[model samples]
Target: MNAMRLRALLLASLLALGAFAQAPARGGALPPPLPLFPLDNWWNADITHAPVDPNSAAFITYLGAGRGMHPDFGGDSGDPSAPIYGMPYVIVASSQPLVPVTFDYDDESDYAAPGRTPGYPIPNEAKSQQRWIEGGLAGGDADADGDRHMLIVDRDLRILYELYALHWTGSRWEAGSGAIFPLDSNARRPDGWTSADAAGLAILPGLIRYDEVYGPDPIRHAFRVTVRHTNGYVFPASHRAGNTSGALPMGARLRLKASVDLSRFPEPMRKIFQAMKTYGLLVADNGTDLYVTGTYDTRWDNDVLNPAFGAIKGSDFEVVQLGWQPSRSDNRRRSVRH
Candidate 1:
């Protein structure tokens, strides 16, 4: 073949390969038509009309009602090599290999007998790919710190595996804690058990995935949130990581007041705020109050997110009655896109 034609063909092949690598279905973040769990699950419950906690005022005050909401996620830090801030998750097939993870809190983690074998399904590529695990680093990087949460979903098995403070010991995986959940069920962890999250809740369900925020459908589930302090845990939350007096519980729900005006914000931000009004935010962990978590994606522009989220203050939200669940007859939603 002519030299020019050979070069052109090579370029075309590279472009096609890039496109395939980026396809959502191949191994992207969560795919569309979501609510990872069943609609009736607490993550998908419609709490817009749920009664507010009588201590809502106190809770709001404790969380600093004057503070504006913060989007705890965004794109790269100018440098393409930097990891974005947010909890990231991966979708794997049933064939994804199950690797044994040694847990710091072994009693609370899921594992096989004898040697406490690693049974969590993780993609092999996570060994070297950033953004596969939380903190956006490859699983084997020992230098990576922070929560370092790792969430993996076996789509074919409809199961979720989440690890907290996850790290690779060069020889094996070690974590602070880990939990597995059947996506199709509403099962809760054993009482007082701490999962990958302090609340013993599924992290993916509560994350504000990029696709769901920008997709055609409205967000249908509660977003995960963090608070500076928590007193205990409520129903949906099976574990307690804090005991600060007068603070909100781990499972506390904070709903954006219907009175909050979302019209002034851009469409995407407005939709997020609207979901806050509808499903509310689930306090899944202890961190900065009103900091909402989402997926790590380069598409996210912090410049747009920062000021937009800052517009809504803590005062605009009210704490829903703790442990409140919608009526069984209330079939009001679908799966969480995360």
Candidate 2:
């Protein structure tokens, strides 16, 4: 390689090492600036910037923030009806075994423009959910169409799998759409490519998780939020708003208040609260205001986190990067061509 390239790599290596050495001992550690899917691809490269439009004031006026951040995943597995709002995710460790699984897709499939044939192998097993599926009917959003979601995180593969309109036929997995994303890569669906998610975005990357909370790592990217209405969308968003009466759009981004103090919470919970200030949250789907989605794990103590969220309300959030660019603003085909 050229001398300049080699020098840049060396400099980056030193900086990373320096940051590692300086990690604070008392509180949760800071996450690396760039996150990769498995080991090399950048996952959250686009979300780290501050909001472009600074429309938090307008958003607060229209779509209220509702309540402080709440933990959707946690606690003993006994509670049948908890983690209210929308769908949750499933986490699988790298060491866990991969099983013979299948994926079924329809109109929403990113694999196909008109949507390709279904019945692709996903390699999942029953043990996969200890988190299980969120049984019962799916919510009535046009995008979700009563199809409950199945979002999986394979920590070992560092790969993320998302399936929509999912239903288990007693023996295997069945869903409307499916997309696999490598956590290491910065790649997104081709401009307007739709994934299993309503926004055509990968679900796992935008979720809240127990490990990211309790461990030294902070959530690097924004968490996916559901809202009742929207005005338009922003770049990196592959779909248009299903409804336009609201103030915010499909891809509108929201950042947590930098002034919101996190020092009072426990170390684990502190990382999540701090993420709100740093990574912020993204508007992904339709649901209750400020409801951030996450994976299902018994370790999460929703009761413990419910009260801590009282500190901040919807007014504390800012709408970063408003969905402008005349072509993308209107509800036409979600592409630059208009």
CA RMSD per model (angstroms): 4.9, 12.9
Cα lDDT listed for each candidate: 0.83, 0.56
Query: What tens-digit string does per-residue lDDT give for candidate 1 at 37-130?
Result: 8888899888977999999999999898899999998767877567758777777766556788888999998873223345887666667777
Per-residue alpha-carbon lDDT of candidate 2 for residues 1-338, written as tens digits (9 for 90 to 100): 99999999999999999765532121121133224342222224333345456656767777655656555444444555433233455555444343333445344454421222323323243223322344322322223235466655554445666677665555655566677765556566665556776666777667676656665545565677877776555665666556566467766777776776778877766777676665567777766677777655556777667777666678777777665322222223221210
Q: Output the TM-score of candidate 2.
A: 0.66
How well does each candidate superpose onto the true structure, as a TM-score?
A: 0.88, 0.66
Question: Candidate 1, which segments miss by more than 4 Å at Cα?
Answer: 1-33, 112-118, 332-338
**For model 2, the run of ten residues with the poorest summed lDDT:** 24-33
Error of 2 at 226 (Å): 1.4
Q: How many backbone clashes does candidate 1 have?
A: 8
